[model samples]
Target: MKIMNILQIHNLKPQFPCTFRTFPHHSLSGSLNFSLRKSTRLSSSSFLLLLVTPIRPTFKIFTVSRIEAPFFENNKEEEEEDEERNSATNLTEFEDLAPDGVVYQNTLRLVECSMFAAVTGLVYFLSNSLSIENYFGCFFSLPIVISSLRWGVAGGRKTMVATAMLLFVLSGPVKALTYLLTHGLVGFTMGSLWRMGANWGLSIFLCTIARATGAVGYVLTSSFLIRENILALITINIHASLTFIFAAAGINTVPSMNFIYSLFGILVVLNSGFFVFLLHLLYSVFLTRLGMKDSLRLPRWLEKAL
Candidate 1:
């Protein structure tokens, strides 16, 4: 039995020589020579058998840990879209949404209007209480200008009416009428021109003309009330001043009253122009302090001079 087992093992070893050839030798040249010799020794039947045999694929086994995340999602595009939607929704959630009609409902604007009316009334009161000259009454128009600038020509008219009513109650109809003839007319004329987007020069020119007309009307009204010609009085004063000047200069000629009157008219016009410029300076300063932008900016040289 032992001799038969040995004989079988020896025959089996020669039958599968390609099984040893499957592993490469240490030397590449030796391995190549062995492969060539093995191929030459193999019969056509053995080569056919080797070709028909199936190869078994080998795999390596490894230990890998599986980690789990609670909020992680598998759809990458959906995750990106969700992030974008969350950001956009957060941005639009707390926007301010105010109504358009709220402009008329502002109590602060009403308060500002009342304050302007009171200021104008106070100026009237001072003019009356102090018995200041009628020319000093020009200062009363400042509040009206401010009101007009703040709220437009309509607001200015309201301020004028309010001021007149206040003055009427305090100093009677005569004082109120005087104010209307002087400051009130100038205020309304300037405010209307300004509100209509007129240039500073044109607006000032119109205001000066309106004021001059008001002065003429006031003079006529005063003359009618006092039974005296105010223009004749003014002409007399001008004639006296010219006679004094000419006497000092050693001139014998006495100019005609018409010449004196014409000179007085020219001086009045020039004075009105000066007043317009003065009012413009006041307007610029007040508008700047009130944080309002002026439609007509002061020239650089004028601003520096002021």
Candidate 2:
């Protein structure tokens, strides 16, 4: 019984063939070969036993763990839309400027308009405080011109109103009223007409009419505020001038009321025409320097002269 137990435990001569399959790899392919040793001696119930031994080195086993693969979603269209949204927004007013060298985005426009209006008021205030020449700083209309060139007629009108409001607060309602009627309206009309791509001929014509209207409006506002007749003063000045001219020529003839009114109207139109022309010459160069090529399409002769 002891010998039989040893033989069964050892099993040196197996009834079936033995094979050890290796893990799948390029270097290791075949199965393992094992040599078994028979068990020895039953000496008074003591037993020695052995099973199998491999001659060559065995390959190591690798345990694989279960893992889930992640899912992938495509959002190419949404990503493209996000990129397009970022394209229009800029960090600064000059950054990502449009072809006319201005950014027309409403949020940016509002900020710039407010700043320019403040500048306009400040310049006017300083000029008055310093008791400078009345004809000085006519270019304070820069705000209105820039607004019209950058954001169109609506922007110019907005700038004028904002500047007028600022001036009303800083100075008085009369100063504000005078500004809006004269230089403010002139800048708005001239800038808007130039930006519209109108030629010098049409632009000058339209702006002259606008300037003349503004002059009339200014006189009316001044007369109403001062509670005096400004038209009477202008007529008196005109009558004195004609009288002096006639006395020098030894021709004594009284100028009629119709003639006086006609002369005043003519003088106003002529002054408006010259003022508008001067603005054209100045802003053509000014806007050109600011990178707006089409702000005013100067004539060939004028362009060459400039």
Q: Cα RMSD to native, each candidate?
A: 14.4, 11.9
Candidate 1's C-alpha runs over 4 A off are: 1-114, 132-139, 294-297, 300-306
- Candidate 1 residue 241 Cα shift, in angstroms, is 2.4
Q: What is the TM-score of each candidate against the true structure?
A: 0.59, 0.64
Error of 2 at 286 (Å): 1.4
TM-score of 1: 0.59
Tens-digit lDDT track for model 2 on 1-306? 876777678874333333323333333444555444344222322222222343354465656888765464347667877787676454444464653445446678898899999988988888888877266656867789889888888898899999999999999998888787777878887778767878889888888898899889889888988899998999989988998898899998878778989999999999989988888888777777888766667899877876
Candidate 1 per-residue C-alpha lDDT over 87-150 given as tens digits, one digit per residue, 9 for 90 to 100: 8866544322222234443444466667776777776778678877565655677777777766
**Per-candidate clashes, comma-separated:** 0, 0
